[model samples]
Target chain A: MTQYAFYFNGKRCTGCKTCELACKDRYDLTPEISYRKVFEYGGGDWTKDADGFYVPDVFTYYVSVACNHCDDPACTKVCPTGAMHKDADGGLVLVDADRCIGCGYCHMACPYNAPKVDREKGHTVKCDGCAERVAAGQKPICVEACPLRALDFGTKEEMEQAHGDSQVADIAPLPQKEYTHPNLYVDPCKHAQMANEATGKVANILEVM
Target chain B: MDGMLTAFDEITLVLFTTLAPAGALAYVLVALPLIVSGDRLLEEARRRLDRFLCVPVVVAMIGLVASATHLGNPANALYVITGFGRSPLSNEVVCGSVFLSAAGIFWLTSFSEGPGRIGVRGVVVAIISVLGLVFVGVISLAYDASTILTWNTPYTPLTTWLNALSGGPLLAILTMRLARFYTAGHKLGRALVALAALALVASVIVYGLWGSLLPELRNSLASAAELAPLFMPSIGLFALLGIAALVLGFKAATWHGEAPLWLPITSTVLMLVAIFLMRFQFYMIHMTVGVGV
Candidate 1:
């Protein structure tokens, strides 16, 4: 069971969104559709100390999220037609475009919001972890497109061996990691926990699309 | 919160959901009592049931059309039942097909002209009537998926059942009245109105309880927190309309002389509108875990 996973070094990401662009271009997606979504999770405020000096607490970081290709994918579980499914070889999640009825149930079931119904194609579409490229021993387009060298993808063991020390990917604005066992590893920034602490809000929602 | 709904929660899906359950319950509730009404009211009840059995079948057909419209490729819809053992959506399709088929068969057989065959028709109708109830149960359970936190509650199925029980009799009595089966001072008509009223009141209570407890569910999004204000007013309107319809219907059914057709017609129309509004609200509040809020 060679499970594929994504590793994101939140400390290095500049939120430039090259990964998002690469995915859209590769898929030739419509404006409303994108296989990859880069969420900018950030929020904080300046505060006055007892000395009456203004202290800046504001922070921001990028979470370039696409399909996790999770260990227990909810999308596949709820898909009536078995269209949103896992790749047999590498265990990456993928959509069988021909079989999709475009009911959007997979879209609804996915906690990662991975699958999107392409109305023009009349089928649900999502990232397939670049299964063909991966099979050929090449990185996914999103990984290769990152300028910050922040994103990585490989077998779960390789990702864990390289960056497993960041135990909990439980960043707010994103859900609890336990929900889906998302094959996503995050080297969360120092202020990343503020998404849960200060407001429990996703800050750069407007910037993400 | 902005991504609470995709293109899925559109008008066609809403109408499909509303009409399917309503139509199934109409057949089950209306026909069940008639099949068991004994010799006293049996002849009159059979006559009324026969005349009206086609109504739910037609409604079910409209629901089938509405459901097809929700599909991106309806040409592939016949294959939907292929995943029946694992998928609730597939199971819903299977149940809907069985219900429509059984109802259609029963409708055709019920039209036989001979009085001697009425006994056989009653037996066939009773079996199909019970199967109709099973369809309602399946319809209720279909939406109880774990992914959509707002819809995954036990209360989700409960609400469907309550809607069917309450709305079914209203539709039934209206159908009877439309066919001139509402004889002056019929106890069964008044009883149906009373039953509908009680079920409607219970539905309101269940709805209230479901709303209050929703925030407590695990993994649920806070998106629904703001939606309460949006939903409460419409639900209140539904309750008011439902109560008014039942009251007016009761008054009309128990009236000593020939009851005015306008009263039951108005009441039934109001109730249908209320149910439609409630279902619209249902679709509007579809928030799943993690992503939506």
Candidate 2:
């Protein structure tokens, strides 16, 4: 399958949340539910290398996140009926409403905390990667709306080629493990130091399903 | 102290939270009618209707009692109806109340002028009584969660429905057996008793084995692991008792030509004890979302 990746540049990101707004608008979300979320954090260490010019060492970055559309989706394994599925090209997990019994199994199973139940619809909502738009030679809504071009979507190789491998860090944190090894890549600056207790090591970005 | 009274342990809390209404439906509406039917020993429709109505009416009132034991705020419960269209909880509140009222009115009608025993009003009321029980099964499915892979799966809702069928009917049969004393014209009681026992066996085996099997059990992120072993009976013991009930039930059916009623009555009593045990385990086995700790 032609796995895709969401390439992000932490250095360039201003944390404006344009990608978040774009994704929410694209999904037609109700209030209190968002498909993409931007998290902001500040880091500084007053490195000894620089002179006494008082360079603020605080580093802040915006992490824009949606479903990685993994190679091994935890959500599908737990669905009693085959309501959740992966698209053939990049394997974006999709929910089939016809078979869904409104059981809420998928919502509980996704470790990324990706799925949400639409109480009004009596089913669930999730990220589909804007598959319909991608198929029609249009960029994902979030990707198109990124004023800084921080959110880039394309074939994994095409994305890696354009942005280089240094961008995405590695490994999505899971409660247990995603047998469906997801396609999403994260390039965390401290990726080498972060350890997910469940996986017992740093997140492995290079794992392909 | 209210603390001890209200301080239900997690599994006990979950069980009472659910079973008070659930058990009330059995004790008040379903089993109660059967009990009244046994006491009156009425074959005629009118008397049966009057007796049957007693249960649903009583069950509706007992719902209040059981709900009090739940220990959630009474005021917040008013919003319980807000989720009506989608939530089984809402449906249960609606159906249970409506059925109770109708059952009460049916019982209140004396039928001095009617030719038939129960007549159309009796039949309609009885059918409604049974239908209300069916919706109770739906309301049982309303324990929604995002991640508790085993119980949130489709199998969970199906098993809930089965538990109601098996557990409720078994209680009814036992109540009738205790009341009827194997009197003449107790064939209907015998058949119902046997049916309830059989359904309990089928459902318990299917649910415990295939429904909540080891794969799902292992995958569960739940608080249940700590509590399940404290309450759940050994699988081997439950199985032996189940098999014994089936064998004794069939033998009595075959040898006596008529169910001695006592034989089934005894079996139903055993079944209730066993089904209640399973209910305890059911609460203990459930996985709360993201609450694996």
Candidate 3:
């Protein structure tokens, strides 16, 4: 199976949230739901020097994230009806709406806040990595719509080759890579913090939620 | 708490967890007299207790119905059993169904048979009683997911089972009193009171330890403490209600004549509310290891 992955360049992303809007527009999602989100992580405070001068040590960065289609997804593990499963062919996690009871177990278990139970639709909805578009050899709308070309989607091998081998999935505002082993790879910016760091918080919580 | 509204969205589930386990255990406790005495129980007392079995049965049924409403599409509920062994939620549902079915069947059979079927009734009650306990344990395990830091702890199941123990005896006392079955100064009455008191004390300690641990549990979005700012206050309220119920229960157990009809009933209601408060806090402090809320 060829595993699909998302590649993000934190240095290029301006936190414009264009990718977020593009995915929402493609899916025609309600305001309460977003398949993709751009998290603004910012923290640090000013310190006074011995010369009585105030110095700033603040930092901020953006992380554009989607499902990541993890290898061992918590959502699929907790879904009672087996409605949530990872596809064997492309290794993309998808939900089978016909079997879903809309119990929200997937929503509760997902660390990335990816899958959401749409009460009106009576099923859990999430990003499928634009499977149809990928089948047609086209990039996802979110990746194509990014103005700075910060987002990329391809097979794991392709993403590794195009980006660098050192690119990782661990960054602030996301859990440790060991948790779910997400398929997202990031070329972090200078201000990027490790996943375990406690210095930053999700600054754009209102916009994301 | 920021997630207080999020927890309220699951009001149906909160009711389910609050009512079902305690109600199931109450059914088991109420059956103890029949199961233990068998042929020794008076025929009229046997008939009265048998008729009163419907009380706990109805309580558990109401909880099951409320839980079904939590599903966005109840028509697809039949598919839940297909996940029986693999899913924790499925395991909980299957266990609850088994216990309820056993209790319902026993209640129906009681109407057809006479006191001579004491052996059969005793055996059936024993089996359902064990199933009831199993259902409580399974429901607690259902919420112990590794990704949920606040719920994954052993304290989660500890508090849940303790809540069931604390409320079950009070409900049993209420059922016995309504049936006009005298238990004042009886060994069974004293045992029930003692069990409820011990369970209440344990629940308070477990909840206290759980609250202390919440401050350290955090993710990028929020901390568990922020998600459940009313944790300590809720526990305090629960303790107050529990003490009131125990006081009333102790009075009923030690009464010389038939206990006042309202004593056990009022105690049961207070304990149920106390259990509900803890269950509400359980949902309020829902914090994941990462960003999920």
Using Cα atoms with residue i matched to residue i, what is each candidate's TM-score against the true structure? Answer: 0.90, 0.49, 0.96
DockQ ranking from best candidate downward: 3, 1, 2
Model 2 stretches with alpha carbons more than 4 Å out? A1-209, B1-49, B52-64, B110-117, B144-146, B174-185, B210-212, B215-270, B288-293
The C-alpha lDDT values of all candidates are: 0.73, 0.51, 0.87
Cα lDDT of model 3 by residue, A61-136, tens digit: 9999999999989888888888899998999999988899999988888889899989999999999999999999
Off by over 4 Å in 1: A45-57, A194-198, A206-209, B1-8, B38-45, B116-119, B182-184, B212-222, B255-262
Best by DockQ: 3
Is 1 or 2 the stronger prediction by TM-score?
A: 1
Task: Please give, for residues B1-293, the per-residue lDDT of candidate 1 as tens digits.
Answer: 43225323567766776677777777765676556653445575567667688887677668877877777766666666777878887887787888789888777765667654655666777887777787778778877766677788777788787777667777776666665565445777877788878878887887777666645532323456354445667779989999988987887677676678888777776776677776766665666566542
Q: Which 10 residues in a row give candidate 3 chain B its minimum summed lDDT?
A: B180-189
Better of 1 and 2 by DockQ: 1
Best by lDDT: 3
Pairs that collide, model 1: none
Q: Candidate 3 regions off by >4 Å?
A: none
Worst 10 residues of 1 chain A by lDDT: A194-203
**Least accurate stretch of 10 residues (summed lDDT) in model 2 chain A?**
A200-209
lDDT of 2 by residue, A1-209 (tens): 68776776665666787887888787778765777666543334555545656554554445566776766665665554556677776767787765554445455456555776675675667778888998999888988898887777888888778876544433323233233355555555442222132212111111100
Q: Is model 1 an incorrect, acceptable, medium or high docking prediction?
A: acceptable
Model 2 captures what fraction of native contacts?
A: 0.04
Which pairs clash inside model 3?
Answer: none
The C-alpha RMSD of each candidate to the native structure, in angstroms, is 3.0, 13.0, 1.6
